[model samples]
Target: MRWPRHVASLLLTAVLLVGPPILLVRLVGWPSIDSPQVALWQWVRDPLTEQNLILLLVGLAWLLWAFVAYFVTAATATRVWAGVRWLRRLPLPTPWQATATGMAGAAALTIATPTAPTPDASHPGTTTTTGTDHDIVEQADTADGVALSGGWLPYEVAEQVTAAAGLVWLRRRRAYRPTRPHRHSQDAQDLAPLPSTVAAIQAATGSRPPPPVSAPAAGLPPIGFPPTGVGLTGPGALDAARGLLITALLATLRQNTVELVITRRAVDILLGPAAPHLRPGAGLRIVDTAAHATALPADARPSLSHGAEGGRRVLILDEPPRSSLANSGATMVVLTAWPHATTWYVEAGGHTRTSDTANAGPRVCVLDTVATTDLLTVTGHLQPPAPDTPTQPQPQPQVRVPRPTAPHHDTIRPDKRVLVRVLGEPALLVDGAALTVRRTAARQALVFLAVHPDGVDSHLMAEALWPGLPGQRLTGRLYTTLSELRTAARTAGLPIIDRTGDRYRLHPDHVDVDLWYFHRAVDRAAAILADPSTAWQAVVDAYAGDLAAGHAWAWLDPHRESTRRHVLYAYAALAAAAPDPRQALAYLQDGIRVDPYNADLHHRAASILTSLGEHIAAADLTDRYTRRLATAGLTAEGALIRGGT
Candidate 1:
């Protein structure tokens, strides 16, 4: 398939060259040749005949036709080959392309975006997103970072979260497809991955990870060099530079893969307010120096010789470096082309010419300031508190709660119950039958409601669902999720959700939550009631696990951690109440397993062991707890010598 055009061109040329000669031969056989020993005198005797003249004309015509055929075929083949090569060289779009662009990003390009469809009130069916939805939005198993959501997260934001999800997928890849840095000497006019391999894999696997669409003019490879100098200049220099910066930061989705070293002023110019939240953090360092406006960080002595090869520290600047960063072992990317050696000379329409090849590179990715700012908000960047945030009160039960049309609208009630479980892996069961929530947003909405029992106001819900995303941009998605949830409630004969004005809350009468049970038990244990130990036991029994234990919903951290502490408290209370030393030790051990870094649980267990004449066991528990806490970035109260010894 790759050379079909080549093959066809070859055939056409062959016919053109042979066709005329064959016709000439058929009409009058091939001309006979003789020695030209007496050529001038011999020509006079043979040339004047009618037969000789016809033969001369035919032979002359064949020679002219063959000459024309050769040049025509050569020209056509050269152009076709160039087109084919360029197509094969095209790269796949970066993962966060659409998400980063955002609704505001539409201004970056002139092409009109299709009108967003109105939210339909029909089926809660499986919706398709251009393969970006394939990312799993749970937290890392180590329980380190927040679980990121998909759907409406800004591209820059998605780049990090989605990249994290992609990282997990990559680690699970059956084969390693190493991405080599494109060398300056070569155009990287590389062929696409073989169709045979992809087709075979596609046939064998189901679409949990969607298949990559291979097109020749799809995307441009991110400009990543190994701690070296590159320049971007042309009409699109600024926009192209923005794209590179975004990509470099996104590479951190692999965690410590790339470190972007930038000056505070450069950050202010490039990112503005977003500069603070995304900086002074992992994989990005903001340097403070009064040396020069374009100087590297004062303390940044990056290793180029013997350091992390896969992990790169890319230092981007407004002007070319006076000192070679390569000697110091870090990448230096400049905003101007022809800074000495022309690396990339891009045009206004995005056509780029690179030093690597004479051919023009594909349309390189670009980002305007607005798009860059928008994406930076979500990606490795944190959200600063909004200036004009509304202080809307939580939805109160006394207010009028309007339900969507149900089995009987007048008789609408939580008369039938649906059990929503979020204490562990979230699940919904209506009338004892499991109801599968298909859309990720809808399920997340359900979990969001379960956590905020008092209900979330419209703006809060929108911002929480897709942080920093404009409500107008997410109107369809929000509507779709809420509409489907409403439809599900109606179908199940339960008033699961109640909305008044712009506030949405789960119906207290109809929907039962396991978290409610956990909270109640916790409240009872904390109360001044008699036999609080029994209440503590109830608390421990009620907590199946942390809230939405597996998924890394970014918003779930506080609630999850808070709930976990209550469980630890409950366990400690139960252990204290136990009459037997062995029973108390058992309680402590169970609590330790639940929260390994809980110093109190470990100490209590250790104390019990020591009193029972097991000093070695106490020491071992202390050592283990110390290490666990240190690993999780916590300070262990009793384990001081852990660092040195």
Candidate 2:
């Protein structure tokens, strides 16, 4: 019952062109034959009169012409329509260009019709005598000859073809026209500039912009800790607290230390983030309520323990133990959300508790979001302690003895062995002997002076080291610390600490600090911009650790973070210019170690590994980094990594 549109169209065309002739033949009483060949022959032989036969033949020819024209028009229209759609998608110089192009395409497809031949000069509208059949036949033959002659096409058709071709040429010329680059000065002139104050205000109020995607090396991970503690009582502090707590737990476990654990959602919050970073053989064991009731150790309360080779086993609890003395015998008990003002508590018996104010034996520490982050950063460098093995007895401590004063006029060269290291703990080695300053304030003063070779006035030093203390008391403390430092320096036979009135600075000639060497390397690398491989290597090597690691002095963070940024930039430049993927990966790895929390570095490393056909390695690296981010409650960023993968 149903037919394709093309098939139906063809049938309708055939019926319109061929139906009338068949009807006329039937009406004229032409004899019918079953066989088509016989019917055709019979019709040809007895189709009645010549006039009828001629009419039939002309109708057939016209039908054939109509069929040919129909197909040709359909084909041409299809091509022109396709071209119009294609042209519409392109960026045209003007809106009217598409219309003009469509018109041109339509015109190009138009077929020109032939013009009638010119009138004959000799027989123009002539009256024919032609009463005879011979004359009439000759006149008919002459008319036929005139009709057969081919003539030139119509003028309009020629014009349309020319116009279509010309339009196409113009369109092509416009499409491929070259454009000139704008001058920098001209570009600057076009843009309106804002006042410095207004710009600064706008920048401060605006949302932080996304990091640029110029290169994989542009973004670096956060290294070390912030100077000020990220407060735990904020809206989003809960997740951060959980992340930090888990990080601390993992750090302790890595050190093969045992501790008591108590938490409800330990599996979801702790194990999830720590899973990827855990070394092989580490395990987490849950202590059920029944086990706690029946299997509690006799001499020692249930305690967190490590498997052989320092594999971690966490004992997650559904609730705090009912017995107050439940974990009294535990080696190290960590109580979460315990109420305390000045001291931590360890459970002993139903009403017996011990305060660990001095942080002695089996220490118990309260957990919170801010505290967790602080502890993780402080204990980041702790490694698993090796198995204990007994040997010889310890030697007695030696008494400090001051060296004889050097002559004032004597030529005293700067001791090359004098080195001040502040990357981790502040340490000073004079003549290859490490000097130990016991007081925390004195140590801090020494570090402050070491960092600022230009020397700091007493007021500024007091302000930085002791922010809220009275001026007189601060002066007393500063003098006392300086005296301690001088005594140590004198014992080492070095004129390391020098004072000029109120200003105190390390004698630069008598000591060389690690930070100074790091800066020098960076400067040298910058100076030799042409070939900086060796100098850059020095820069990387000299940065042994973050500036004043584990110390979060208010004034020290900015300088520390600034140095880290410079080191990252140097590494980024090196990676970008590396000749091969291997060299680039090496540079990137060094950067990653310095700033392991940086997602961009991990993404870049994964991309390079993917390009090198290391699919498994790339997946592993991406997975591990994403897990780390998840631990830190950065699921949005983790999703970005997954999407990229």
Best by lDDT: 1
Per-residue alpha-carbon lDDT of candidate 2 for residues 1-645, written as tens digits (9 for 90 to 100): 456987988787777656755775666545343787875777788887775576576667557766866786797699999999999997755768878988888987895644744332222121222232210111111221110011111111112222222222222222221111111111211121211111211221111211111111111101001111112222222332343344334434334343323343543343343222222222222333523632455323223332333222233333334443343333212224222221223232101122434432211112332223222222222122223413211111221111112222111235455777887667877776798877666777877876676777988887566542346666777787788887877765767777899988877667677766666556566667576776666777778788788754534543554456446656766777799988998887888777666555666678888888888888888777767645543332433343235
- Stretches of candidate 1 exceeding 4 Å from the true structure: 1-223, 233-260, 271-308, 311-313, 323-328, 343-416, 436-440, 466-470, 473-480, 486-494, 529-531, 575-585, 596-645
TM-score of each model, in listed order: 0.52, 0.36
Q: What's model 2's TM-score?
A: 0.36
What clash count does candidate 2 reach?
4
In candidate 2, stretches whose alpha carbon ends up further than 4 angstroms from where it belongs are 1-414, 633-645
RMSD of each: 24.6, 41.6
Number of backbone collisions per candidate, in order?
Answer: 7, 4
Candidate 1 — which pairs collide? Answer: 99-155, 100-155, 139-552, 147-552, 157-378, 157-379, 304-329
